[model samples]
Target: MNALPNIVDSETGQGLPRYDLRVENHGPSDLEFEIWQIPYNGTPDVKKPLRISGLRGRNLALIEHRVLRLLAKAGIHLGGLNIQDQARYALNEDQALNLGLLFRTLAPMRNRENMPMVADGIEAMGKEEAAYWLGMAMHRKYPRRVLMALRFLLIDPKARMKD
Candidate 1:
């Protein structure tokens, strides 16, 4: 069975997730990319690890939106946690790391060359790139920290729960 590329610890030889991303010209100056979520041996640089080349796309809006909804839903499941803990957990570095990992698994997509979302005629995106845009959009609209996002999501997990 095929697996994503990852780096393993040199000492332990234990494999771990590692990302390899690239953005460059694909056609006549239009940008494209090659991205991988490697499950490599401890030392990716030193080890000749296998890699998986994920599909490329012009945008990740759909996947990101879906992921955010899913994340909020998962958090909502843990209703036992108080608001303070829930909000705090949302901002925790470890949570961010896990989210970062999740970002690598999404497939890429495309858009019209002149569409408002992306008129640049781009052809690819890294798994989490859409999440970056989503974050920026959220910040632009709300302009706050984790607790605010947490509160918003918890109050209505269905708010952003798009299919």
Candidate 2:
């Protein structure tokens, strides 16, 4: 396995920053994962962390939308304590740490981009439209925080059980 890259402070761009996880291939087989950088407070310096994990071979596009719905119902903020608690409850220690890192990176960028809800009335979304736009905005500004928020949101019982 290759040495994991050092987690850097997003704002100062300094080294020796502490992140939730530093992903590296543990096995000989090749693995693919996505990395998102989430910012906080609209400042490039105060980032959360990096999330690195293996995909479960599911349809991520669909999962992403479902997760958005969960977030909307939960009323959980990206970097809020509720989200952190949820991450702890839903994921294992390592997963939670990874998620925490991701949240730090993504939360700051939430809603930074403008994604119109309606465009020519062509039935723009099937589900979780608002969440999708929010995620997109998060991705543009802070990719990691958005993922962390989504991770917890998807597994949050209160968020999912709502009508």
User: How well does each candidate superpose onto the true structure, as a TM-score?
Assistant: 0.25, 0.19
User: What is the lDDT of every predicted structure here?
Assistant: 0.35, 0.34
**Which stretches of candidate 2 lie above 4 Å from their native place?**
1-27, 33-139, 157-163
Instruction: Tell me the TM-score of model 1.
Output: 0.25
Q: Pick the candidate with the highest TM-score.
A: 1
Clash count, candidate 2: 16
Error of 2 at 44 (Å): 28
Q: Where is model 1 more than 4 Å wrong at Cα?
A: 1-19, 28-30, 36-49, 52-55, 60-103, 108-156, 160-163
Span of 10 residues, lowest total lDDT, candidate 2: 113-122
For candidate 1, write residues 44-100 as lDDT tens digits.
Answer: 553552232322343443443443454475452323433223121222223333343
Candidate of highest lDDT: 1
